[model samples]
Target: MSDEYQTSGEYLHLLSEPAWQALRTPVALALRDAASDATLLDVGAGTGLGTEVLAAAVPDGDVVAVEPSPALRAVLLSRLAARPDLRRRVTVVAGDALGVDLPARLGAVLAMNMIGHLDPDGRRAFLRRVAERLAPGAPLVLNLQPPTEPTPVPFSVFGTVPVGHHTYEGGGSAEPSGPDAVTWRMRYRVLDADGTALREDHADYRWHVIPADALLTELTEAGLTGEVGPLDVVRAVRRT
Candidate 1:
């Protein structure tokens, strides 16, 4: 679960293309109306993918890229070395989303594909903390996978099972050598009370899905107005 493995330059390079493409447009549009002088935070900013996007959007503003993995932070630092303009505007911090104190009041907070990795309690606590840190009317954008119902597999045992049957053997399980081997991918959805589709926010989400209704309720309780947009994304803003 540690982010250390993600710091590889090869890995970071591989991710650059998709991460920029998926986040740039939506994020740019979201910040289009903000003043050029606004400040921003990119949470879980692995390898500066989202940070790069934010940098492009707010050239005259400041960006703080907070990442938990030291390895990834190293890569991010190296990447920033080449772009002097961005290097001046961006500050890289090594810290977890749940523990770090945001350095300044931010105009926008971007949490992309990072929520699900946290345990349930951590997720709720993080959201509440985000509400507290945001400036009045500031927007918090969270992209995560929706939880899906688990599929059940039925099995029956007519007689007592031997204890040795459950013991592991060195041989272990057999591997499928061919591409035809069956592989399953879980799909989830985020829906409002009226069954409207909310945009899917992240390509890789870590934890169990958070229901849309539950999200809205949490936002309301945190003193924010939650809006689930058409793209499976949720935008919550602090009340004015």
Candidate 2:
């Protein structure tokens, strides 16, 4: 699988409002303690939804929104450009967080709904980088989804929303691709007022499942302590 959000990113933005509604509170709570003037990092910031949240969370801080997908970056940039306030506070960048050149010390890190993109080795490298660059007591917040081991996920409608004169639907299914990974098949559809399909797009991506224990152990090995919170969210803090 290409695993990049080439085509999917186009439609994913349409459903972001609902996702943001669910994410807003938890994400804010996670970053509530971050210093107001500290620099914040947002990894895999697709379409800038989480980036917007981060900007709101730290009004006085600079936010670095890192996205590796060009399609997603296009939308992210557009979003920033439209809001001069966010445009001033956010610096959009390309590539993985581990490879990007960031500040010597970070105030907080947000990696929402993107950790599965990294394999075990990549995860280790990312955590190590976070450990090295994150300011002492700064938090790295991310989530771990289900099927920690490779397993099949049933096809289900993830979202269905009605716009002006059309309805947009999106859903996905996943199949075991390896011992610790799954290949997700996503389907998106646009239906006219009469309920006829006007367009459809299909995409596939890979996700490497990480068990809670495995991730906590990795955090500890990287000199960070982590706590698993509600909704499978993990908040790890760099050691002093």
Candidate 3:
């Protein structure tokens, strides 16, 4: 199985419940006004949890659940089979959001918590692609964890010397330490920009830390205007 699919399948159970709840509220806020028969795209639809929410909201609309993982695709197919009503409204595609052919003229694009998986360049490219696919004013809902606060230390060290006890510092440490040490955990996903996963084992090979402001800047550079609220999730819009 492909690494993307494997990673998705492995986390499917964990996402089945919590993800549904976490994403439902935001997705609804973005798409509630959509026509009942609107066509929606769920990019990086891991196990179709978000897709299910979209499907539920627009019972008569069509939802394209795009996922790059082979294993998760099969699982999603099985889940669809169990619900014929939703099955008819949803189409499962084995593809990546960064470079997939979206159906012509979509009403909205739902990119839930998937942007963090991409590097800065890749994220920009994906945003541009999404903007291209969406209709005017279509919303791109992005959910991501914000960077941990940086600790500040108050100390004045003028000369850098190996041996020197100058004076007592009056400020605290500037960086979080101990159990609060902030580090981006390595996460794996299916498919790279070249359309190949590093390995079939779905091993995580890199760690990433996303600064909220930097990410927003990258999105703006891509022609999408949005804001990351204090809650840390970004909801950007593609203007007509």
Candidate 4:
């Protein structure tokens, strides 16, 4: 998890709904072979949307949702509390993927939109651990976002939605910050019905970029084999 989400986390749903909807079926289909009792690990489980998807995918199993951002965890906990079914199946844990206390054997793992938080070395180390822990034949599913290299992204409005008498708008831009990373500058704004800006918040965070070849190499070194599925999502499994 990136500290950058502390301020902008509240507005995540406005931008992520479509992605979540599109991901639900693909993720579930990927995990269809999971054991009935295995515990699913959801790294970077922001606000519990992905957690819900995992819980649904494995009706008889449990899900551990790991999120390091307190602000985001607060929302996640609230969502769990409100949904009795999820409350019974999902446990919210507070820590990043590397620091969180994970189960000894995981049925599967989901790392959507959060892999950039880990630098190159960290990602390799994390992959090795996941390879060791994931059940044989189980999958580690993640998505590689754009700007696969350290590249500049021009600012643009990414999302807008109405909320009562106000409209919330979110946008971001990124610039090369290092050989393998970019710094994202994000802005969230609230506008009155008449379109006057009511309030605005800004946040910045570093995102490590991993090219497909590099990621595949790391996966191979970690003892896992990976393939790009629908929507370019990577499904990596430990080699037999």
Candidate 5:
């Protein structure tokens, strides 16, 4: 499973206002204090929603926003360019979350919206590698919907949303591919206010499901003390 944000990046960054607003605050809340005073690895940092929060929290520290998708990285870089101050705190890079080399050991790891993209082995390996890169007792945050909930599907466009010059109509369906995998089909169309179509994209991807406790066990075996946080975020601390 590729952690590529290519298909959804532009939409999410530009006109997916409702979704972004819903995600930004909570994600930041989950990640804000996790990396205070230390360099952070915002793994799978799609367009930097979570990265922005983490960067702001650690004012003097640094963040290496490791993104695997060129489309997503472009949006993130543009934002960083617009805010010169963020360059001092956040450095966006294109690399695989599991395989990227780091400039420094991380005080925290933020993996959001991409865990389900990995297979079982990749999930376990990712936690292990995160443990290897973290400072002792640093946190590893995995943000997503709880695995126990039934997947959402056939979702209608949630009230047409307008963001800046673009209006978006988007929704999709998620079907269980198997006990561990779910296939999502999303279609989004961007239009100008005058009703001219700007661009449309369709994305179909598969994601695997691993229960929160199962993931915690994997982290524990990798030498981290782990638990599901109050908001369904997985929080683990590396063992010294």
Candidate 6:
């Protein structure tokens, strides 16, 4: 592992499992209804939680799982390697949303907690790529979390999250970095039954948040018709 992400990679895949557990089912349902049995793209698929959902929702469909982080992708591939059924339905790729080539005309695209990693221009470019690769009327589901309230607020997101057989102990802090950005730093420790810390990880990220209306306009310009849904969701359909 590279020094940049070595310390951060251990739990980068496990820490988010709790949140994804709640969101994955609904996402699978949405994608299944949108265009099941078609190629689906799981952008920034992380540890492949979303891909697992997609696999179950559309058993006959294929998923292009893309993640840029090597550590995360390693976890993702390992997970998939254990599931031959899912492996048959998924093709894992290590690339960002903008750089990766579309494997096929996508029936749907699920991007969760990913766009915030991009700047304004990068976001636009990514949307443009989605537009280009999307089949007409295909859905592009986005999980765009709202920024934490109030600038310069002291924020600590901490919890003991259970995954499969083990637990993860993690906490995070974030501060407003700019009018449209936040600097978030987090650390985690994977624990065993005996309270032994098996491995530790950390990450620092700067998220760029664009306003809802502005994002809608950008999506519209990118040939997607969309509306904001409950819980910070932006569901868009490729224009025919």
TM value for model 5: 0.84
lDDT string, candidate 5, 1-240, tens digits: 363456776576655445656766655655544545567888888877777766765676778899888888888888888888887678877787667887467777888778887888888888878887777667788855534434656655644678788887776778878778878787788889898978878888888877777777788999898766655777788776
Q: What C-alpha lDDT do the candidate models reach, one value each?
A: 0.61, 0.86, 0.61, 0.86, 0.74, 0.77
C-alpha lDDT (0 to 100) for residue 54 of candidate 6: 62
Candidate 1 regions with alpha-carbon error over 4 angstroms: 1-9, 32-38, 146-206
TM-score of each: 0.68, 0.95, 0.69, 0.95, 0.84, 0.85
Model 6 per-residue lDDT tens digits across residues 62-91: 788998888788888999999988888789
Angstrom error of the Cα, residue 179, model 1: value is 31
Q: Go through the candidates in order and give the clash count of each.
A: 10, 0, 6, 0, 0, 0
C-alpha lDDT (0 to 100) for residue 141 of candidate 2? 88
Which of 1 and 2 is ahead in lDDT?
Answer: 2
Estimate, for each residue in 1-240, the C-alpha lDDT of model 4 and write its tens digit.
347687898888766776778888887777666655678999999988888877777786888999988888888999899998889888888888788777989888989888899998899889988998889888898888879989999999987889899988999999999999999999999999999999999999899998888888899999999987787688899999
What's the ranking of the predictions by TM-score, best on top? 4, 2, 6, 5, 3, 1
Q: lDDT per residue, candidate 2, 73-135, as tens digits?
A: 999999889999999889988888668887778888999888998888989998998888887
In model 4, the worst 10-residue window by lDDT is: 28-37
Tell me the deviation in Å of residue 198 in model 6: 8.4
Which residue runs of candidate 2 sit more than 4 Å off their true CA positions? 1-3
Question: Model 5: which ten-residue window has the lowest total lDDT?
Answer: 143-152
Give candidate 6 regions above 4 Å deviation.
1-5, 36-38, 148-150, 162-167, 190-201
Write out the backbone clash pairs for model 5.
Answer: none
Q: What's the lDDT for residue 35 in model 6?
A: 61
Q: What TM-score quantifies how close candidate 3 is to the native fold?
A: 0.69
